[model samples]
Target chain A: MRAVPRCVPCVLEIAVNTVERAVPEDRQKEAILAATERVSELYRMEPTPQPPRLGTEAQRTVMKYSEDPDPYREEKRRANERAAAVARELESDLENIEDPEELLKRAAAAAIVGNTIDFAVAGHEFDLDELREEISSAEFAVFDLKPEDLRGARVLYLCDNAGEIALDKLLIEVLVEELECDVVVAVRGGPIVNDATREDAEQVGITEICDVIDTGAEMLGLLATEVSEEFAEELSSADVVISKGQGNFESIPEEPFPDVPVYFLLRAKCEPVAEELGVEVGSNVALRWEPEDENVRRWREIVR
Target chain B: MRAVPRCVPCVLEIAVNTVERAVPEDRQKEAILAATERVSELYRMEPTPQPPRLGTEAQRTVMKYSEDPDPYREEKRRANERAAAVARELESDLENIEDPEELLKRAAAAAIVGNTIDFAVAGHEFDLDELREEISSAEFAVFDLKPEDLRGARVLYLCDNAGEIALDKLLIEVLVEELECDVVVAVRGGPIVNDATREDAEQVGITEICDVIDTGAEMLGLLATEVSEEFAEELSSADVVISKGQGNFESIPEEPFPDVPVYFLLRAKCEPVAEELGVEVGSNVALRWEPEDENVRRWREIVR
Candidate 1:
């Protein structure tokens, strides 16, 4: 989504957090100020500042000043460890579910609850201890697709943050085993904020579940022009795309895949995203962007 | 208080709100963009961006772009009306108290609770209906002076927002009639945000209660150097200065009124102010800034 005036502070906060994490104690202030300046420069220069783009640029500024390619390396490690433990505890619960659709919803809810692990979004507070309760009580503000919609389909799962990916593993397992879908998980080509990388997915055992690919860009959202041809080809050819979080959901254009059924599974963590989805902030959202009628018709024909 | 990274969004939100209120619908985007640019400029230029200072400058940028002197004129008028109604409803409760100390605390709490009317502070939400309940429950987080301390002394009451000034009227009455303190209520000389002006004080009947003066400048917080000489003199000569709201508390230097006891009567609405006062955010604060020991000694001598 395009940046609103409110995004200015949120983006600055992301910059400040990234800078503080990247730079030494003595140089943090200088780096933070410089990153803030970069945010200003982008807002001035761009006709419409895209929040994710601004955040990515600000993160770039912090990296440049600190001379650290991966500022969130340690943070990602910690998040992964925490999420892995939670996922381990949740595995038995998933195993107990009999019906495929019920198991799919349960796992999807867990995945959306896990999106709260995102540190890039401003003012988002996640309590890992409350995960089970949140998942159990989770209701989709928008549920456009059923588990049967993706049955035996080629599903491309887009990953968001490090800790969130551990729970995404649960969803991936459900899609592969319960729904009988072929899944290819895509992580960020490089680190930008706390977005999951290939290493993060591997650390969380996602590589063992299915094929893993990179977006071939270290940006906030997926820009069509910025990704690798292979990834672009995969995006277009996949029968359904399970977008994991706000970044991927935002980056994907309205009509990027006209014939593809993309399921956005995330918690509407901020006002803009919430507004865009027609849901309350903090609501668990599972939406399918209305694609061209021909695509829906084609998908139904295949299902029949 | 020096602005932290968190203040960036807050200051930007203020600018956006101000510009939206001031400028035409067609020109709002242009004005907002320009105001954001100004906020960025100040952050880049100033060694430490004071949020109130940044806010004032951002408002100035909005005024310049919109070509309107007072963007909050209508908002202030509405706030005054709302606050006045609540004050009228609260007058009997304030008047019913027999013990002078209890009455003073009640009036002070009402005044502090009324401070929730401020619109400039980002994320501050106040309900006019809840005023009475809040006043009843309000407890000072850092009350250094007793009601007896201001007895028969010169008290310069610095007013904050428009609606809040009406409640300050109640506190002023208690100070005058109960404590027998000589009171002078000071407001901003020019329009800035929703901060009280001479007109607002008069509209709220603060003029009828006691002597009303102006700070002789348009700015956020009271920068001693920027205010008129008359205000500076009043500030220095007063036996006890009763400062109101976050802006005034932020602007007043740690040791500015070293020879006089300055009672900062405000709601610690923001994190910076809460940290400065060592209280939780949203706490009612009636702190006597610890002045030099000589001032306290002399005040006790006078009391004896």
Candidate 2:
């Protein structure tokens, strides 16, 4: 074999491939568009190599594993176990609380502290005091929140990635302890992207602290597929719904439950969503509302 | 909306979209695997801060334009015109020659040089003398001359980006002038990946030198669908086939023509192919011959 010249087409192959595997299955088209934008941004921001080579084999291997079914399931199982354990721990905390509002406050505090530790280790940084203040001030004035609304509400905390499971655990604890909510921490049924799987949740003790379920590997995001019969019953009867990550946002249509108060937490990593929110890309968001009402005011305030 | 801090998942969504686009309709699963391999490689090589993000809106816009029906047809039309022009130029060169052996030698040299320059820039550091010496020394070689066989030849061309289309132009010239072979110069169908497009080929006068075709809008690797009748006829009658780039290798199957000789010119950017070749990933290669018993000795020597 004679040596061929290294060229631009090869480099581009690597770059495109790298970006492609990073996306989840349901959002493949959106991901491709985002990758294109990022590449263009990189070119404009700096003097990149003219023709980026395709990703190296090692890189491709990692991407393959990231999307493998076994790893994803393992991650989910671990998270579920962890959530179950946390729920037990919170059971004792709940017994100690007398006031419903105070319990919610305590649960929210635990969630913040727990999630902060997890995020920090995962290489994320945030202002703890500010976050706490924000949570403390979360009033029904912005949206609608009634005691009956959250009582025994079925909450699903969809996880994202291995390292982030600990944070999800914290959030589950709050729903169970403070809100007195029936919580089900759902891990992806199989691996599609980097989202948590059943095993990952178990490993982090998330399953130990809450009821755990699988979303059957559907990439519909917030518009999660019908849960197992038992889980579905819980989901349909629940009053409050919480979905984590933008995949859920894309999958869950904006009008599924007009009356149910759903809280969506995600970072705006792509343009379409960011542009819709009128925020810079890569900004984090914690949007809450009932699909039935025109919550444009609430959305505006949150985006601002 | 409060900042959600789950941008990683959002980025994953974009990656998925990119992979879906890169994959052809029929080979979605293989394309997905190829994409996963490429992205995984990137994750392993680079740090997390350069965490993979999705394509931007601008990139998607470019992709849309590339896939537009009219532009695709126009690019093909222009490419045909360019190939005819190159044929005319080769005929002029042949008019001055009279010996069959000399004509064959010139044709082979032209094929090698033309293919090389098709995806590379002019004034590239290609050592023409070295390439010529390698081609002339080969014995018992097979030529993959069928256009149909071009569909799945795992070609890998090392590239330098944009301004180097001239190199590809020169290589196409050689394919016509020396080898007296019918050729297809494949490019990125749309603008998502940084590579020569049908338009790029037309812009650099490449269409005039050879048959111009799109490798679809694929970014991970090259994939060969059913050959067009015109190109298939050329392949059925030809004696040698040449392919360029790592994308070509990823997209196409390796043994499209079990009996004919196929030449792959690529830079090893990813692991699977590099590992198979026992070469350092990212190294360039110009591998020749059929993977059949008749060419065993030649194959072993070249691959070795």
Given the true complex, what DockQ would model 2 score? 0.02
> How displaced is residue A168 in candidate 1, in Å?
2.3
TM-score of each: 0.81, 0.40
The C-alpha interface RMSD of every prediction is 2.6, 12.6
Quality of model 1 by C-alpha lDDT: 0.78
Off by over 4 Å in 2: A1-162, A170-199, A207-225, A228-239, A254-258, A268-283, A293-304, B1-164, B169-202, B205-242, B246-263, B268-283, B290-304
Task: Indicate the residue-level lDDT of A279 in model 2.
Answer: 63
**Candidate 2 C-alpha lDDT tens digits along B136-248:** 44231223233243333332222222333443454454445543545666555555433455566666676666666653443433322333444444443445555555444
Residue pairs in clash, model 1: A9-B9
Q: What share of the reference contacts survives in each candidate?
A: 0.62, 0.00
DockQ of all predictions against the true structure, Cα-based: 0.42, 0.02
How much TM-score does chain B earn in each model?
0.87, 0.44
lDDT of 2 by residue, A1-304 (tens): 0001111122234334444445454443333334433433332322221221111222233344234334334334444444345545554554577776565544444443333333312233545455445444433212223445576676766655554565556556656766678787777665543456676766777667787787654332533223344444544555666766555554444423324566656555555455555667755555665564443333333322
